[model samples]
Target: MTKNNALGTNVIAQIGILVHDIEKTSQKYADFFGVEKPEWSLTDTLERAKTEFEGNPTDARAKLAFFDMGSLQLELIEPDQNPSTWRKHLDEHGEGPHHIAFFIEGMKEKIAIMESKQMPLLQKGEYTGGRYAYMDTFKDLKIIMELLENDN
Candidate 1:
């Protein structure tokens, strides 16, 4: 694990994998887990997400598939050709486990804390009732940490 801050490792809600092919990888995961492949979707144009990279706006897009793993979720991401943290990982390291996520209640507070800890924001996206951001944790834990918030 990485160095502990207020939001330690206990809040992690899911593990996200960077995949070269969402369909292929999802099928492989399904076969390995003895279940059907979960449906995947690209960023909806109408509901299209707005993203930021290293604090600057970006055209990042990705295909995503989610699977329920009881208390946690398993996410597979296949990034599009837009500049994104996911694309950077895929380009630099290829497909593999990219990040772990924490579904936080007050995402803004957590993001501020993470920033205070010097974990610069790598990517962020906003949707209808939720938003998510990836912070640089690779230097500490060899994986990124995603802060997620859903308005429920």
Candidate 2:
């Protein structure tokens, strides 16, 4: 098994929130945490990202923006339409923390380590020219933490 220093790892690179309304979600974050409002973009700019992330083409409908919190990035994602992932999550759990992401170098290795530790994966797949695996940790956490490995 590979030894990964807990402190050495960047545990939370980004956070995601699934919302039906970008404006509402952004406002909530800004007001609650005093986080500055983030910039929002449509599919035009996201086309270039179609092959860079782990999400599927259906994710293309998402509107994304970022705000920096120290070295971490807080990502606010609003799906373009109903019956989407954001919609599903919001319908089930309301607008809230959807996932936490860890940007790692070797996703396969990390996955192997997690599996060796007997951690069950909620989901795992390669997409958009990158690799991502999701695992559930602890009870009541609700949100899954995503392990992401980008080619870059």
Candidate 3:
């Protein structure tokens, strides 16, 4: 990889899609892929996740389903009626591909680099074993970029 590559790796770790009905959509995807339907679950509570949107704390949550596809994962998200990037995308753009994610280390540094390049942080949260940040890179890349840093 190039020395200037802010994300460190070029591999896409996951692709997230926003959907209105994760249950139906995930089932469809599972059938299409010939895999068992993955169980969908809600994100952690705001108290645990410490989720933020537009720089402020938020209670926004989503139902999430994941499918392992070789080197990458396919994520389906159905957001609650809250002010989050996921909800915003679903409202404005309708259900569709939302973001492509990269698993990386030094999340803070990577976020700083992306921000310096004009991609603002739209949302961020902590999961059970990791944290995630969504960068607004649509102006240049035509897609949101999700940075995932797992504490394994």
Candidate 4:
């Protein structure tokens, strides 16, 4: 697994760019930056894989495909039939970097640290493999912070 120094702790980390179309954007980035083919996954597929989110016996669909851009991972998201965080972001703001996710082990502690600094969390809920927490730091910048935990 990849790791980086965040808030003085070694954390799983990546920079992300939110795009409207995955394949198109991935190609653009690859051509412009001379990068290789990107790794992709659908959010619905991920959600379906997680029993915690499934709750019922049904096929799950994901609206996201991801590309690894060196140290950064660019994620393309499209809202499927079901409601998703990506859907909400696209609905609210066009296409852009919706959030900067900092993956850490202790979500609660990370949240507390942010809260202590007076940064209010915008969304708090459960999704797919693990828990998630979000905080909006800027509206014009179209940036937010995401705390994610994966079962893996």
**TM-score of each candidate?**
0.89, 0.62, 0.98, 0.61
Point out where model 3 deviates above 4 Å: none
Model 1, span 1-152: residue lDDT tens:
46865465476699999998899999999999998899998864323676788777777788999999888999999988878898999999998999999877777778888888888788888877898889997887788999888899
Check candidate 4 and list the clashing pairs.
43-62, 44-61, 44-62, 45-62
lDDT, candidate 1, residue 135?
90
Please state every model's RMSD to the true fold in angstroms: 2.7, 5.0, 0.6, 6.0
Residue clash pairs of candidate 1: none
Worst ten-residue run, lDDT, model 4?
51-60
Tens digit of per-residue lDDT, candidate 4, span 20-87: 67778777877887877575665434444431221232233445666666665666655454444555
* Better model by lDDT: candidate 2 vs candidate 3: 3
Candidate 3 lDDT over residue span 1-152, tens digit each: 99988899999999999999999999999889899999999999999999999999999999999999999999999999989999999999999999999999999999999999999999999999999999999999999999999997
What's the CA error at residue 4 for candidate 1, in Å?
A: 7.7
Q: Which predicted model would earn the best lDDT? A: 3
For TM-score, candidate 3 versus 4, the one ahead is: 3
Better of 2 and 4 by lDDT: 2
Residue-level error in angstroms, candidate 2, position 78: 1.3
* lDDT of candidate model 2 versus the reference: 0.64
